[model samples]
Target: MTSTGNIRPMNDKKYKHSVAVLISDGLGTFEFGIAVEVFGLTRPEFNFPWYKFMVVSTQAKAVNASGGVSIAANYSIEALSVCDTIIIPSWHSYSDKKDALLIQKLREAAERGVRFLSICSGVFLLAQAGLLDGKKATTHWKHLPKFRRAHPQIELDENALYIDQGNVICSAGSAAGIDACLHLVRKDFGSQIANQVARRLVAHPHRDGGQTQFIPNPVAKLERNAISNSIDWALANLSEQITIKEMAMQAHMSDRSFHRRFRDTTGVSPLHWLQQARIAKSKELLETTNYKMEHIAELSGYLTHETFRVAFKKRVGVSPSAYRARFRSD
Candidate 1:
């Protein structure tokens, strides 16, 4: 397998990584489609080489997907040996019964340092193969209880949209898989390239994996729209010191009502949301600019450089300078 541990800058003329999308019976077509759309599609418009993609199966045969769809896999599991990354779109039935041969191959692949990505219930396959025993993993929220019961050793994060444990990555559910895959693109290429890919897909360019999943809401449309509008206003004014009272005023609700409705709409508190938004903005500036730390902090809504550094490091797990060093596009 090719080395994906240290990806170089995106200025390279060619990206040599080969990505294999693993398909099996009872596949989630939407999740499978997400993988194919992100990694499989050829983007001739880009100046560099896109991923060398292929669809593979455990038995190298046709498999049935959800909703009565069937797809024929031209490559077998043996093909994974030469691939740099394997995307397990989904598993068959989320069953406890493990495929001995498949498990052996997966373990071998892990030993070789090949990357593994599981979408939704596909985490079950990795868990059953013993790949996620001591690692942090997450699946669709609906399966959290069962996942915990089955894999008590794995540290499960209930709120994360996705979790990237170095070589192993797991996504929450169907749509979150798109964010996870786009994140891999950003890691391999740069933020600019990833943003372009996202534009083509008509999806959000960047959603931090730590952002909480959208909880089901039975709130009225008017209330939801008000909260959404307030969120938009806050985003537009991220450079300013935004107060909860100001936000509540924008939503046209009392502070208490705004608090409850905001939490109901977005899984985090209003303050938490503002902090995350500021962090996200700081990250974008860091990735795209060579500005000084103080200037970046000011632009990201921090009152002082010290506060910005503390908040950024706390939220992102790294200081601004270090993050720029790792992910800066130019």
Candidate 2:
């Protein structure tokens, strides 16, 4: 037994989940990459069970990605109705006609309790199929205008990074796809597996999608640029005290404007954004390195193990020790 009292790895059966990414023409390359990276690749070292990712097309022939990149799918819509989880990467441009028959396949799966995920404009396809009706959802902020007009029944959340409304989930835009996928992994397997995958991908392990997506897109004024610079600086000095006043001062904006714009920019409050970032740092340490919890707490900006415990459990729904015990590969 480890001195930290983390549990021993369970002798549990690996769940060979069959995941299918439902693709159409004009799929976003980055969104599709999320599906491929999460469930498509195999890592022998991580051990345990993994998913069998299938790229399924609605047509018989080839499909073109958004950037004109062509993809060869292994199956067709027939497989979409049969997978453990069905991911709607993105709907083709709204100007295009969404095939009714293809929507039916995904709708059937949703009705049968199959896990459904949508990235960017893909929520429109789910909305058109009536799967997102009366459910809270989101998509690329730019698409919100047409999306809301087309489907008023679905509750569209503009500020969220991704909202997992149980069986169905939606992400805001291209990059938000990572947050949605990581949330899916944590929900299915545990924090351990999700964190490991993030490490392998060398990406941010956690970013609360609920973090606001309203940051001005074109990299606005010099002040906004300062905010961006401050963000990078805070991340490098996470363990340092990061207060709203301090961040605002660094960005050269009035505290009130900084507060409003920070939420506008990141979709999360400054404190929450930092906490999520800190938690991600801590999760990485817990899984890949054998750092003691005390040191992890210090590095992650918690003043003590008890504070880290409460914060970690509140955000992740698991005790740090328990998470490490059940998921650490070595």
Candidate 3:
């Protein structure tokens, strides 16, 4: 019935955070599992406190998940008031009638500054609660049309993998939920801890929330592998002055062909991907090492400190020094 795995740690230290995953009937098991795997699992390997996670529902009744599975909540909706964050894994449907009691609870939690994160269509609940009014939100591409029609007041970002509006966050379909959760972990703990959790899950450490959600055309297997290999090579050589010609050579394709395929596979231009990769590398260095801005810029493939500063500020909305001071792991 009720499950509270790893909510209690070995030591008596207070948990640094608390999370409540709200579930309902017709749940997306994969999304629910993502929340559980990321927040509910205990990591004794880490020295710091982890989240105290629990499942909550509007009622104590068991809900039906996909594939004929049933899950019961560990706590009632009232438990949400005590949580630092509340995760809505999935909801019934856009057409389903709103739950007034649950909506009231969500509004109350928002007023109290509890962070709300919704995966996929679970955003509908937040939208119904008026918590996402005038705020940008995203959902599975399939649900975008209905969501837009239903909540014209909410700004819909169909291309984004997730949108973080301060206390409220909404993620796109399925795997994108993992990215959103990891982003939260990175924000709350640090990149190092988030990366460690990502490693355990065998997922990418970070994906920019603004990154395009899906590639339009799927490349053939061989072509896909070639594109993947090129990305791997680029990541390995972030410090090098990588050119489109060089990346094409690595992929064994003509420059034009490589560019097309890379965009088709990754949903972004090759140069844009490179810039994002370099920014990611610079962020890791900023958070982990005491390297000066010039050194970090060099390591992140920028030839000049001015170029690095401009790029970092444009993409991250903060300067290198500010990012380092805020997110550097002690």
Find the candidate with the highest lDDT and give its number.
3
* lDDT per residue as tens, model 3, 1-330: 553344543254768788999988889999999999999998888887888888998766799898899998887777776778999999875475978888888899999899999999999988889998879999999999989889898889989999988899999999999999999998887678889999999999988898889987778999999999999999999999999899999899999999999988887889989988998899899999999999999999999999999999998878989888888988
Candidate 1 C-alpha error for residue 82, in Å = 2.2
Better of 2 and 3 by TM-score: 3
Q: Which regions in candidate 3 have their CA more than 4 angstroms from the true location?
A: 1-12
Global lDDT scores for all candidate models: 0.86, 0.79, 0.89
RMSD of 3: 2.8
Q: How much does candidate 3 score in TM-score?
A: 0.92
In the range 1-330, model 1's lDDT, one tens digit per residue, is 222233333354566578888888898999999999999888987866898777888764588899998988757777776778989988853578878988898899999999999999999999998999889998988889989998898999998999988899999989999999998998777667888899999998877787787776678999999999999999999989899999999999999999999988877789888888898789889989888999999989999999999998887778889888888874
Cα lDDT tens digits, model 2, 224-300, are: 68879778888888886677788888888888888777776666677778888888778777877798999999998
For every model shown, what is its TM-score relative to the native structure? 0.88, 0.71, 0.92
RMSD of each: 4.1, 8.2, 2.8
TM-score, cand. 2 vs. native: 0.71
Quote the lDDT for 246 in model 3.
93
Evaluate model 2: give its lDDT. Answer: 0.79
